[model samples]
Target: MSEPSRPGPARRSRLLRTARRWTVRLVVALAGALLGVLLLGRVEAPIGPFDATVALRPAGGGAHLDIPPLGALEVDAYDGPLQLDLQLRRVDEVRAEALATNPVLLDGVVDQVSEDLRDAVVKVSWMTALAAVAGAAGASLLLLRRPREVFLTLGVATGLVAGTAGLAAATWRPQALSQPTYTGLLVNAPSLIGSAQEIVARFDAYRASLEDLVANVGTLYSALSALPAPGGTDDTVALLHVSDLHLNPAGFDLVRQVATQFDVDGILDTGDITDWGSEPENSLITAVGTLDVPYVFIRGNHDSAVTGGLVAAQPNATVLDDSEVTVAGISVVGTPDPRFTPDKDATGDPGSLEQSGEELAEIADGLPEPPAIAMVHDPRQAPPLDGAVPLVLAGHTHEREVTELEEGTRLMAQGSTGGAGLRGLQGEFPEPLTCTVLYLDRATGALTAYDDVTLGGLGETEVTIERTVVGPPAPDNGETGTDGGTEPTGTPASPTG
Candidate 1:
């Protein structure tokens, strides 16, 4: 046996060169494969009523779900070099129109939506797999030049994509969906997407309770609307006034029912929609969006910047912070509170209530057109605004009140729309949940009359509505009184819960 078979130095060098050349080729093929997959590893499918695209990309493993203008959400559901992204494009026009006509129809179509979603996923998977392989092979051919190299690279690419996908499937954690990070308007994704099973069970129960509460409230308002109006209601703009909801689910329900029944052009909320203004609390703001009417809001002592942002993010909402806006032919101005009393101690702006009130008055003065109404969370902030606007609306004391300022400005201080919040339950007697519907002359934008609707606390439900007509400006008296020279329009039959 010739053990003297050792190669010459030239042969050894040739071997090394071959190894280096193949290594470079392998690296290039892998890069090309990744590029191809990223460019074409996507497929469009019908997900429920939405036309959506599912794509695979070169990224830190996970999933990203995007719903255009509304926003996007990201979850770390899996681990690998490749990630998935789902985007909703155009929605089915017929289904969209149906939802627009009546949003409640959504609950009835849940099962169909789920089935469509599963079908879309299954379809997308096969399409994406084919796209990945074809893309990889095409890209490798462009770079490799040789048929043998291209074929080998194509096989390698297939294995790589397959393995990555398999790994993701094996490691995917449904729990990650509960803690997704959010962007844009979908900042409250957690409220909609919780963990699997247990969270789903809890959410279902909560939803059922909320629906029942809304149904009962809606029924009461239907009965109340049956009472005859005082006439001259035609050609008048109806506006719903709500404040101090304190994040009560029922509060939004009441607003929705009243707005729908009265056909109000807009909703004016004087703040304290949430208790702490925390991120979790912001989720409740979605209820405001569901109202489907223009919503104008201001911050209350209990609200924070977070609360304001959430409300403003709603497609139909406008946040007034030392600003003015017109809704349904009515001009309005509002300023945030000088203090944020999250606890016993107040915080935020160092300016006194007097100064804040003056600043608000100045803002109203600066507007292009004199406002029809001025809104403040606290009544103490209304004195300076007396002459700046014809009417001022406020809420804070948890009790409804009507007052005439020395400057002839008529003020209507609203009661808590949330029955003074959860705290109302602590009292011996149930506090009433109250709101006002303002009737304004379309041509003059003047407050003609308003109805004060008060309902007994969360569980109580007895409802009362008083129609009050305003008589011109209390003779500009120096003293402040609750009457404002307005007369009530006799008690009509009300609903009892």
Candidate 2:
């Protein structure tokens, strides 16, 4: 067979010029389209009471929500050349507060946010498409300097944008919301992302739970506010005690509600903030920063260095691992647990628990001044610290107990603030979520009184709060002055935010 005929020099040169010309057109077109979207693809709209913006940017095809200050939540919504960016901007505090407090307002807020998000998405989509086409045409006209080439480039850009949109819509995965990846804390995940299908779905299933929380807060406040505040001196500081949250969302919500209703000066957590020390469990602790009060934490057996680090990273959080911090006019010291019970990487000696307690006691005693309160994850560590501090707090058994030691130290063992976390629901009956509100005399840092708060187990919303006044025996009751508290008061109620 004869060899294939070769093109003449003049014909080859013509073909090369044509190929180079087309390559330049494609490159300039892509560059212009990217710039256009970068400049004009954003749209701002009010989502509920929040001002949020949506934009398209170059990324590996996913959606990201920027919550500002706290952190960001990212979801794999789709695959494409461009990623979706949602930025949370100014919020109407008055309206937001009302929505959080009122269930009726929250219902309207859900619908309002849905409508606003839909509108913003639609607007941004159109803006991005137009900008891409315009940019491609402009660049082609400027560089190619040929009207025919510019027109061709505009058509190509428009086709490409539409094709990309079609691909994204086709590949959109709603399941991504179930498992989102986040930067910072995962608590602030995007409420409305993925396909538009969920926007119209009803979320009333959570209304009763929310209502129960609101009603509980209101009734509890009513019951407590009617009584006079307790203290030896007029200057008394209040603190909220929580522990064993184990990554429960409802538990965190309750914590926030109780904190707000009581207006506590600070919060003391005895640890186990997550079920597993994995990265995914960081969401529950994110709200710790939003509590708007000093959060003092001690690591429990279920906690790890990562959990402690996360807490320490928060703006209002302080983690004490054999360290001391003064909050709300009270000096506090704490020590982390000897080991994470479920840790696979390290098997710290459980036998060292007592030794750890002794070390913590020494640290507390060595402080410049005796601490008002000392913290440990397990009650096992409480004995050694009896004389080191006036009060010692610990949690680990998921039970509440108060005892006055021989050396004159009061040990307050808190229950699980998260109902022992999600594991509490695995059995026939769920464990009750419990916490306490402690009152201290500001001048002398003396124990005045405390309220033990309990929420009914999972699937139940009933709440009960018991008031225990600490002081000398009252002659009126004629009862013995035991470590067990007197003047016990209880009320039924339910809470969350």
Candidate 3:
């Protein structure tokens, strides 16, 4: 009877230890689950129509198109789902299936993969919990075994802590989980993957051509800056203002080097720093952090729609999405290009442009005073701001250096600061070769339109800035100059008030 009673006490002790071990495992699992949630929530999915325009066109089937670089997409009218086919090439078939079945497909491939990936994450969480439970059991057992085993068990726990912490930190941010764009999953899958040979060939061709254009333009911009200032002295802030450098670090590097070499007082990046609006730790952010000067940024159409997260991360950088800010003594009002109503299913109901000239007018009214300069995404959008503003700085066109607009209101098209070059997916490289537009003073109506030709060895051409009087000289003091003849004696054309 005494022997049986002794075994019962030992059994009770074992049961108690097991319960404590499970409790520890549960804590560890909870910790891992929370960490995964925090990291994934921040991941970005870039969405846009640029990729579609480049890779796909109307091939067949309900007038649909496909862009493999973006995804196998089927585009049609947005109102109703009609005849569709998404051949690894057609794209419509995939869209129709996705529409009828899993809407997650429309969310983008990343979202689809994430759903599958979640299970893996849960398994790892369970494993972590299990390890912690085992560790606790081991500890309890050691404590029970003898007073001296506590030291050994403590050593084991310390090693486990170091190992687990290091691994969790290392693999916390995954680049794989972040590649989905707004249009669809960028990753390759049999159901949607297209021709590899074609993609590679096209990419190679693009790369070579891009290299040539970049080299040429960099040289041109450098050359322009080297030109003697119109006035002997620098009248106003002469800084490089570029925007929409979507995730191109090489381009950003050039901008930095030019800024540093020229000793520009400020560097203003209008917006769209990343290819996608919400990606925080990619090449773009890494490069943006390297600049050691005051950098001002305004959201562009792509910036707000694709990589808006960069703005939130860099507090020192000012982000003027729908606001106004002053830089280098010039008050600037900034707005992204008109919004487009995207077809979520890749069915082509032409995207609607949602430009807010009225909103800008309202913002302009609140200005403490008239702004000397304004930065916008599209030069064509400048009309809505007629008479209210003097200068509009924009970059969507990526014109070689400067392409003057129709309005007397001077337009500055700051070429590619950096990102997939100006060719876009259509393979139309930046115009003006090695040029960027510059305006000396909006208040004085002084504008300098030329390419910066400084980046050597990038195949850049020398661009010259020649000023030609467009219309007959401003009405000469109410007495017009006779055709090709001298003006009225002693009557000079006074500056337009």
Considering lDDT, which of the candidate structures 1 and 3 is the better prediction for this target?
1
lDDT of 2 by residue, 16-108 (tens): 998887778778889889889988988887778788889988896889988766578788989999898999886777877788687577768
Candidate 2 lDDT: 0.78
The digit string of per-residue lDDT tens for model 3 on 1-497 reads 35544557788899889777555544443343333323321211112211111111112212233344454433332211111222222234444455435534443554544553454334434444345435544544534464444344444444544555454445443342223222454332212322334334444454445455545444544544545443333564555677656555446656776667555655666555544343332424645655766566666555544444455456445656668776666676777656431211232111221245446656776787867666666665566665566566766555534433344455555655553332232223322222232435434533432224322212222223332222233464675543212111121111110
**Tens-digit lDDT track for model 1 on 159-246?**
8768877998999998887777889756643433333454455434443544445555656667666644333666688899999998
TM-score of each: 0.58, 0.59, 0.48
C-alpha local distance difference test of each model: 0.75, 0.78, 0.45
Candidates 2 and 3 compared: the better one by lDDT is 2
Go through the candidates in order and give the C-alpha RMSD of each one to the true structure: 8.8, 8.5, 18.2
Error of 2 at 68 (Å): 6.3
Ten-residue segment with the worst summed lDDT in candidate 2? 191-200
Q: What's the lDDT for residue 309 in model 1?
A: 89
Residue pairs that clash (backbone atoms under 3 angstroms), model 1? none
